[model samples]
Every structure is written in structure tokens, then in C-alpha cells.
Target: MEKIKISKDEVTHVAHLARLEFGEAETEKFTAQLNGILRYMDKLNEVDTNGVEPVTHAIARKNAFREDAVNASLPPEASLANAPESRGGCFLVPKVIE
Candidate 1:
């Protein structure tokens, strides 16, 4: 498997783009970690998966839910009773805009 090498400058550039400031120690540490992850991905690329079939779900099942139906809603008076203020059967809240 080919090895991956991440440089300090690349790490610093990425940090700057992300609006983060990293010291020298953090930059070196992140470089080593990112390179290690890339090496692992390269190793995974060697696997032979030509005959594998694509799957959308782990368990072969369709929608497992009840059919939708119309339901009764609470009366407006009961719903507005909980509000601190109401006008003409409508809940009133503080105006958000002038």
C-alpha cells in the first residue's frame, strides 16, 4: 500500500480557511493524524468488491407504518385558554417588528 504524507503547511492552510488558529504542536499532530487516515483509506481501496450488490436498507422490508388518516383537532377555545393574551378567538403575541 502507498503511504500518505501530509505537510505542516497544508494543515496550517486548512486551519486558516476554517477560521482556526493552530500552534506548531497542534499542526504537527493533525498532520500525522490526517496522513494516517489517508493511508487507511488507501489500504481499503485494495479490497475486491466487484460482485457486491448495492443495498438501500439493512433489513429487506417496506414502509413499517400505519396508513395516514384524518384526526379530530382540539377546539379553538380550549387551545387559546393556555395563551396569556387573545383577541377575537386568536392568540396574541408581542409584535416582533415595528
Candidate 2:
């Protein structure tokens, strides 16, 4: 299997691009972890998958859905009974966006 090499400089460059700053120890730790993961992926590339079919999920699945039905909803007063704040039959929340 081919070996994966992750240099400290390369890791630092990636961290810079991601706007992340890491200590020397953390950078070294991430470098080693990334190299290990790449090496494992390279090993996986050596597997024989000639007859194996690619699947989105491990198990076969079919959509299991129930028929939609109309139902009566609670009255506005009842629905907002437990709300912290309400006005004009609607929940009132602080403005979020400028």
C-alpha cells in the first residue's frame, strides 16, 4: 500500500486557509491523524470490489409513508395558551435579523 505523508507546513497552510489557528502540539496531532486516515483509505483502494455493487445505504429500503389526512387544529387561544408572548393571535419574538 502507498504511504501517506502529511507535513507540518501543509497542515499549517490548510489551517490558515480554514481561518483556524492551532498550537504546535495540536497541529502535530492533527497532522498525524490526517496521515493515518489517508493511509487507511489508500489501503482500502487495494480491495477487490469487482462484483460488489455500489449502494447508497447498506440495507435495501422503500419509502414507508402514511396517507395524508386533514384534521381539525386547535383554536388560536388554545394554541398560544402556553406561549411566553403573543399578540394578534400570533407568537411574538424578538427581531433577529437587521
Candidate 3:
């Protein structure tokens, strides 16, 4: 398997793009961590997966729902009765300034 090499320059570039400011110590730490992760991924790639089906889910699943049906709702007057203010058969609120 090919080895992964994460350089300090690449780490610094990534940090800049992510709006991060890291010191030299953090850059070195992250470079080592990222390289280790890449190595693990490389090891995983060595596994034989020929003829294996790609999985979308691990467990059997079904839509657990009932058919949609119209339900009774309160009349407009009752629905808006609790509002602090109402205008033209609709609830009103203070205007927001943007």
C-alpha cells in the first residue's frame, strides 16, 4: 500500500481556507493525525470487496405511517380569539424593522 504524507504547508493551507489560525505546534499535530487517518483508510482499501453489494442501510425498514386524512379544525374566529391583536380576520403583530 502507498504511504500518505501530510506536509506542514498543506496543513497551513487548509487552516487558512477554514478561517483557522494555528500555531506551529498545532500544525505539526494535525499533520500527524491526518496522515494516520489516511494510513488507516489505505489499510481498509486492501480488503477484498469484489461482488459485495453496496449497502444503503444495515437493517430492514418499512414506512411506519397511517394514510393521511383530513381532521376537524377550529373555526377562524375561535383560532384567532387568543391573539393580542387581529386585523382583517388574521392575527397581527408589530412590524419588524430590517
Candidate 4:
């Protein structure tokens, strides 16, 4: 059996931080589960990863965005044509800040 890596108090503190309420039994269960996970992590640390390259993602990812290209946009005169009020080729609105 693995030694205790997480205590009941630590589990309760984490629950408080996450705004979660747990009874005594739930806290005990979580403490045991967390300790098991930490012990498994300790086992994983013993593996040799010296030759492995660090990766940002588990699998390869391709750029999902469309190719950037120059495109014509609506002219300023056309844009301000529908404004409630316009001043010097720009839309005018009420002052938002003092």
C-alpha cells in the first residue's frame, strides 16, 4: 500500500477554494483518491524521458484559419450613409466618459 500523499485537511482546503462543499465521508474519499493519483504520478516520474521531445499538444495540429489575403472593404462614405448622425466622414455619438 502507498503512503498518504494527500491529507483530509488538504482536500477540504481545495474544496473551499473551488467553492465546493463536501461531507466528512466525501472529504475522506477525495483525500484517498488524490493520494492514489500522486502515488501514480510518482511511478510515472521514474520513466526515462531524456530522449523525448517536449510537445505543446498530445497530437499534431494544423492551422485551421483561412489564408490571409488583402480584400476591399466598404468605403467610408457608404459606412456613414446609414448613421443617425455623422460629422466629417465619421459617426458621432454621445460622450461615454467624463
Q: Rate the local accuracy (lDDT) of all candidates.
A: 0.85, 0.89, 0.86, 0.88
lDDT of 2 by residue, 1-98 (tens): 54557788999999999999899999989998999887777777788999999898888779977679877899899999999999999999999998
- Summing lDDT over every window of 10 consecutive residues in candidate 2, give the lowest-scoring window: 1-10
Where model 4 places Cα greater than 4 Å from the true spot, the runs are 67-98
All candidates: TM-score: 0.42, 0.43, 0.43, 0.49
TM-score order, best first, reads: 4, 2, 3, 1
From the highest lDDT down, the ranking of the candidates is: 2, 4, 3, 1
The sequence of per-residue lDDT tens digits that candidate 4 reaches over residues 1-98 is 65888789888888999999899898888888888888888977888999899898888779878769978999999999999999999889999999
Q: What is the lDDT of candidate 2?
A: 0.89
RMSD of every candidate to native, in Å, equals: 9.4, 7.3, 9.8, 11.0
Clash pairs, candidate 3, are none
Off by over 4 Å in 2: 1-24, 70-98
lDDT of 3 by residue, 1-98 (tens): 54656678988998899999789898889998998887777776788999999888899588978769888899999999999999989999898886
Off by over 4 Å in 1: 47-98
Best-fitting candidate, measured by TM-score?
Answer: 4
